[model samples]
Target: MTATVTAPADRLLYKPEDAAEVLSIGRSFVYELMAAGELEYVELSRRCRRIRRTALEQYVAKLSPQSH
Candidate 1:
């Protein structure tokens, strides 16, 4: 039998490539952001990584200016 997995209510997580596309940057740049702790990611395995939509939103918010 095969098992099915459901994505989170918010939505499925973004892969590095998807994240890069969303940010309008390169995949390497996404890795750099992760390394610099500017972006958060989840490690599913030694070879698998994903970025939550909320984390991406938070990162962008951090880069945005505060309103008066």
Candidate 2:
């Protein structure tokens, strides 16, 4: 038997590393994007940060040719 996983409807939370993996870019680039305000993030604590999955999807959508 195989198990299937599904994402939540809201999908508004992601770890920095997970976000980086989803974008297929370096973690450093994720920081750069966050610093540049290209990606929105939430600071959970002094040493923790998270990105919004919906925001990431929106960002990608904006980059699509049809969106431009």
Candidate 3:
């Protein structure tokens, strides 16, 4: 039998790539945000990390509007 994966809408955690997709930004920028502590993530292990959906929302909520 094959295993089933969680749908995007039902997911609480997201990989960096997934976060990038949701944010419409590049994956590298997601990593930069994580490195800079702008975005929060859960550390499952030394090599495993996942970003929470709330964290993404908070990040967006905190963005200042740009002046043009």
Candidate 4:
């Protein structure tokens, strides 16, 4: 027998790649942000990490407008 898993309708956490897509940036940039403490994430295990939805929202909210 095999079981399949499905994601929730509303996601509370996102993988780095998913976060990058949400932010419209590169995955490597997401990691860089995490490394620089610019982005927040929850470490699930030794090699697993996830970013909270609110964290992503907060990151965008904290961004200053660019001068033209």
Candidate 5:
């Protein structure tokens, strides 16, 4: 039997650690990108931040050498 994979729901969001894993980088790098204004994120509260899938993809695309 074959199993099919399903994508995450639209409302699903990822934290810095998750984004780091997806990008194969260190967690500190993710924060550095955010501090450098390279990655877009939303502040859920005074201390909470969330990164969207779209933002992560855009950041990767922007960093691609071909984009330069």
Candidate 6:
């Protein structure tokens, strides 16, 4: 027997650090992407921001194709 678990569709927000982990990149790179307007995020306040999972997926999809 096995169980299949999945995340909720409404669960989309993630911290920049979490995004970095997901992308296997440095946290500073995530900030740089934000600064370059390449990654989309929502500012909750003057010091709080959250990146949407959908945005991350879209960003990956928009990247240039990798060479073999």
Q: What TM-score does each of the candidates earn?
A: 0.75, 0.71, 0.85, 0.85, 0.76, 0.80
| Cα lDDT tens digits for candidate 4, 1-68 | 22222334499999999988888889999999999999999999989999988888788878877789
Measured on C-alpha atoms, candidate 2 has an lDDT of 0.75
Question: What is the Cα-based TM-score of model 5?
Answer: 0.76
The global Cα lDDT (0 to 1) of model 4 is 0.85
Task: For candidate 3, write residues 8-68 as lDDT tens digits.
Answer: 7678999999988888889999999999999999999999999998888888878877789
Q: For model 1, what is the error of residue 31's alpha carbon versus the real structure, in angstroms, after optimal superposition?
A: 0.3
Overlapping backbone residue pairs in candidate 2 total: 0
How would you encode candidate 5's per-residue C-alpha lDDT over 28-61 as one tens digit per residue? 9999999999998999998888888778767766
- Best of the two (3, 6) by lDDT: 3
Give the better candidate number (2 or 5) by TM-score. 5
* Candidate 4 Cα errors over 4 Å, as ranges: 1-9
TM-score of 1: 0.75
Q: Model 3 misses residue 42 by how many Å?
A: 0.7
RMSD in Å for model 5: 6.8
Error of 1 at 32 (Å): 0.2
Sort the predicted structures by TM-score, highest score first: 4, 3, 6, 5, 1, 2
Better of 1 and 2 by lDDT: 1
Ranking by lDDT: 3, 4, 6, 1, 5, 2
Each model's number of backbone clashes? Answer: 0, 0, 0, 0, 0, 0
Alpha-carbon lDDT, every model: 0.80, 0.75, 0.86, 0.85, 0.76, 0.82
**Per-residue lDDT of 1-68 in model 6, one digit per residue for the tens?**
22222324676888899888878889999999999999999999999999988788778777775579
lDDT of 1 at 63: 74
lDDT by residue for model 2 over 1-68, one digit each (tens)? 22222336666688878888777778999899889998889999998899887777766656634343
